[model samples]
Target: MTPRHDENTVFMTEQEAERIRNTVKIRLQRCSELAGHARETRDSKDAIRQATGASLMADMGAADPDSAQTKTQRGTLPVIAVGQPYPPCMLPLRDLQPMKLSNLRMDTHHRGRRLAVKRASPVVTLVARSWTMVFDEEEGGEIERLEVCLHKTRHGQDILESASVFVIKEPYFTLTDQGEATLRIDHPSDLVVCQDETANDILASLNEAKDDVDGVTAAAEKFARACKDHGNAALEKQNLPLAHAKYTEGLKVARQNIVSKSNPDLARDLSRNRAHVNLLLNQLDEAKADAKASLTGRQDQRSRELDSKAYFRAGCAAYNLGAYQEAKAFFEEQRKLTPGNEAASAYLRKIETRLHEQENGAFNFQKIRAGLSRSRPRADAASFVGGTEVRESRLPGRGRGRGLFATRDVAAGEVVLCEKAFCVVWGHEMEALTAMTYDVRDGGIRASPVGLTRSVVQKLLGNPSQVKRVMDLYGDYQGGGNDNVPTKMRPAEEEGPVVVDVFRVHGIVSRNAFGPGGDENGVGSSSSASAGLWVRAAYANHSCVPNAEKEYAGDLLVLRATQPIAAGDEILHAYHDGSSGDYSARRRALMTTWGFECDCALCAAEAADDPAVLKRRKELAEEADAFVGREHWAGAKRVAVARAKRLARDIEGTYDGERYEGLPRLAARTILEWLALAGQRR
Candidate 1:
């Protein structure tokens, strides 16, 4: 059976799929012939008419794949597979002929917003091939070609370079609303660069001197130094991708020359510069490898400064990876090479604190809080790993998904989970950057998802091995596939490359990302609201009467149990501000924001309460608030205390004791606190 273009399952035969492809090719050929004649026609009026007719025929032929015109004609022809994240490990390559740019058409099914692709199974193995081409040029000043928008693309922006050859799998070709043809690649895994030995054929096609603008044919040392200088210049301008690319190009040229191996200084320097760029780009594994490569050359007085910097980069990369011991050793080595290095000394101190947290779970929350208030917060702390585990959430109405659960009995007020955010976009950064996106539902301008989304994608692309950290979390996904995500990280060469669907990342960010500031206790000032995604912490499902409460320390989310929880109990928290006890208001908020109705103990009890009784309770609570405000009046303390007691008692009477299960009454607690203060004053 052949795969269907509009669905995941196969419904057509291989012969039928071929017949449809031939039909499409014949029709497109006719359209091109008509267009060619229109260009050469002698009569001006006839040419214009012919050209318009040819365009209409093309648009009709390529009408969104789901549209009636194309669907009726195509009838489930095998297209490319899309809308799913890539496999965690690589699958064996399949032998399939490549699709060309000429055969591309508008994806009317997705309204040209995404790619239309299909997967075919050869026996039991499913294989996808790619279209190879050299990047010709970028469109205008946008810096994105053959992909969706800058923010939506994998690796963020400005990654594709002119003259670089790469393969694009499951490519989406369409004519934009403005009538320009484009090839859009939605997933980073879909585009693989052809470099090193594999890129030899493509490299041979280009002019050597023109392509080697940095003098690749010159002496190995001279060429390597030129690349280093180019990389350093790009770094200064904050073009990290270009700097890394230049350094990479230089390394390839230098490594091929035996002369460079004899005098490794230039080669080592190139690697060191690339490592620095990789570190800044959050490509931890690459940065670590580059740093190690930089260390192999002579470490005498001449190269002492460079070696020290390499050690420092290695330490930072290791620390980010949570290899505290290795990071400590790197820092210590750096200190030995250059005594009194302040940066290395600071990292050593941080490593000591991280080690304490790793072994004993002891943390200085007070110190972390102090650092969070600075204009530029430092949340470089590592997360604790063993307190809770991700398990299947056993809730009835909720679909098959994972939840965070306590691994052991947790006492009230004890830290249940402390996780550093995977990526955080500070409020100040958003404000200064002036990047804002409006939400039609909220009807207000808010912090754009681009900043936070880009940061997360950069990290994921830089270190694809860690893709599961974000991918494993629940998100706004429909029936794309099963929950059989790989449990263990695998090497790409052994299995296959992990596929990162940018759309999947965007969906996860929307459902799981949190606004970290708006209250006094959070990291930034109240006026500026920051956004972040905490991968592990996000697994906790929402409950109105949450078992755990969240607090912030820098970019870290500290979850503490508000009530004693059993070993296997699922951790839960409120997704919104639950200050208002109005049942209808709470229900509306939860349903609108999270797409779920609250079914927690409190919501269940409140759902059965009498409307009038709840209304009276709200009225009395307001009266008590007014009375508490007049406490500064002369001779009013006694009256205020008496009224507060009556109001608290009245509010208590409104709630059914068995239904509420002795949940704290928000209004009653307020009045009781005021009465206690009044008694203390007396």
Candidate 2:
């Protein structure tokens, strides 16, 4: 008999639930073999429902219907919902090993889990406690509860809710600072939420209208063609991600179907189109592979054009990766396939230029500057670099790592380096200008780390050949391995499936990226911010009184000597507007943002000054700023000019005389400039 209670209440004891389960088993056994199988499934479900209700009531500690204690009880765990059936295209979790949370270790990444939320905390950035189902036996199961947290993902907080099922890919189990066990996911791509649309795709990919080979071939071709058309439309609209996804989905269908051989034409076209998309997306390795795939299969004789486009894509990928010989061969083949191919001809010339630049430091910098003046920047311009080499820093502190040094004595105003930006993202191209909070300590909603990070990852994943160029850059990786960042650049070799941790990429971008500033020399300034990463420039260390200045022209970065420096002197530039702020303020800003304290000569000189003197100087500087900010009273220009001169003198007195002997009094320069302008007006 079912227990009776109020509308929202159900009461039953453990013994009573056990009796109901026995009755269900006995009733199921009495039926015929085929009938018994059907009865067992239904009766077993009914028994579980009753037993679960009793167990939940016990967990809630609800002894009385109207008890005050019931209202004050802890939040109850949500009952597991039977999610939509697993898709036919995917192998069920039962077929593969699902990771047991109980076996997890600290500082390790573990794989496998089909999770159902038991309960979830209010997501700050996506967190939940999920029940991991264990399908150890054919007829029974077990559950292991685990805490999961997704960090720095684009998914909204509400994506994790009660009873939502998910399949965690390469779940990284680790301990938080508070000594709590949690499965932390830093990459958004790591978690695949099992949504209805995703389920439908899996089902649709498997289904066929007719059973014959011709029928299967027709179905596959139709789906692939639709994907290609949709992808082409998206590409035309400049929706790169969507186009890549569409092409990928079409390729997935082709891969799963058995009758793909009967339709090589469809497969060939899909690969070729996807290759073109990959090239645009900066996925060079995938582009090259797809390009090669497009040419391997039987040709579509009905279609008129030669496979010159594939060769072009392959050549472009190789060219960007610094494989000039391979790129030259591919471009030559493309020209042969289609006579009068201007793009191929152009790339061949570029290859020659690149080969010449690599052999020696000679570059046609004049030609590169010509392209920089255009409204839309092109990254195809040849790089010009000489007189500077990356070497270990000779600073007092050994922790300064490496620094750039002049190969020869460099004169003031002489160009030391000019190189194209590895990747650049203009602010106008972003779909939404939503502020992303990576963390509070980093000053929140930074210039444009998100879009730039995505661009960097795509490029790295597509071209493993360029791994050595990037992997050596600094980041905040604390994992057990070498953090995948080599101290020295690794030699160029064939690498398989590079594992890029997005968190590491975020850290690197935060440390080295520059935003648009007022002038070419104003790197890391906040004016009209657009984020770009310049590979060679990242090696230079920071200094308040920098020896070098940076200037940007389109996607190109040119470094010039601000003062004459002998060979072996380390090159440095201001990471921010380090000239305006006082010593303490500058040090504080650097510490908070970059997690480092400045110990340069200028900083050390200012650090030795009397605190009272520094404080007075700061006050006078503020007064001068306030005086010049608004129009003064009639005939008060003389008074303002006098105050500005006095403030500039006070600020100059705060700097150390001996240590800062040759360095410019940068802190006082602004006030002095204002004073000079005021005198001119008088």
Best by TM-score: 1
**Span of ten consecutive residues with least summed lDDT in model 2:** 80-89
Instruction: Provide TM-scores for the models.
Output: 0.67, 0.62
Instruction: For model 1, give the 10-residue run with minimal summed lDDT.
Output: 120-129
Instruction: Give the Å error, residue 95, model 2.
Output: 12
Tens-digit lDDT string for candidate 1 (512-628): 887665233333322233678998888889887789988777678888899999998999988874445566766876664465787776777777888898788778877766766
Q: Candidate 1 — which pairs collide?
A: 64-108, 79-118, 80-117, 80-118, 81-117, 81-118, 89-496, 90-495, 90-496
Q: Give the TM-score of candidate 1.
A: 0.67
Q: Model 2, range 1-682, lDDT digits (tens) per residue?
A: 1111112122334553344334333322332222212111223344345334543554465432111111101122111111111111122345445554344445445544433322222222211121222111323432222333222322122334322455555555443323333444444345544432442354364563445656655666677678788889988998776677677767766654463676665667778888888787667777887887777523453332447888888898788766788999999988877768899999898789887775554656677656553245544555655567888887776387888887788789877777777777664443111122224233222223455665676566456666566757876553322244333222212122344555566667767777643233222212123578888888888888898888766676777789998888888888874355466767766764566888887778778878887787677666655655553433446666667677777777777677779877876766666665555556
Highest-lDDT candidate: 1
RMSD (Å) per prediction: 13.5, 16.1
Q: What is the C-alpha local distance difference test score of candidate 2? A: 0.56
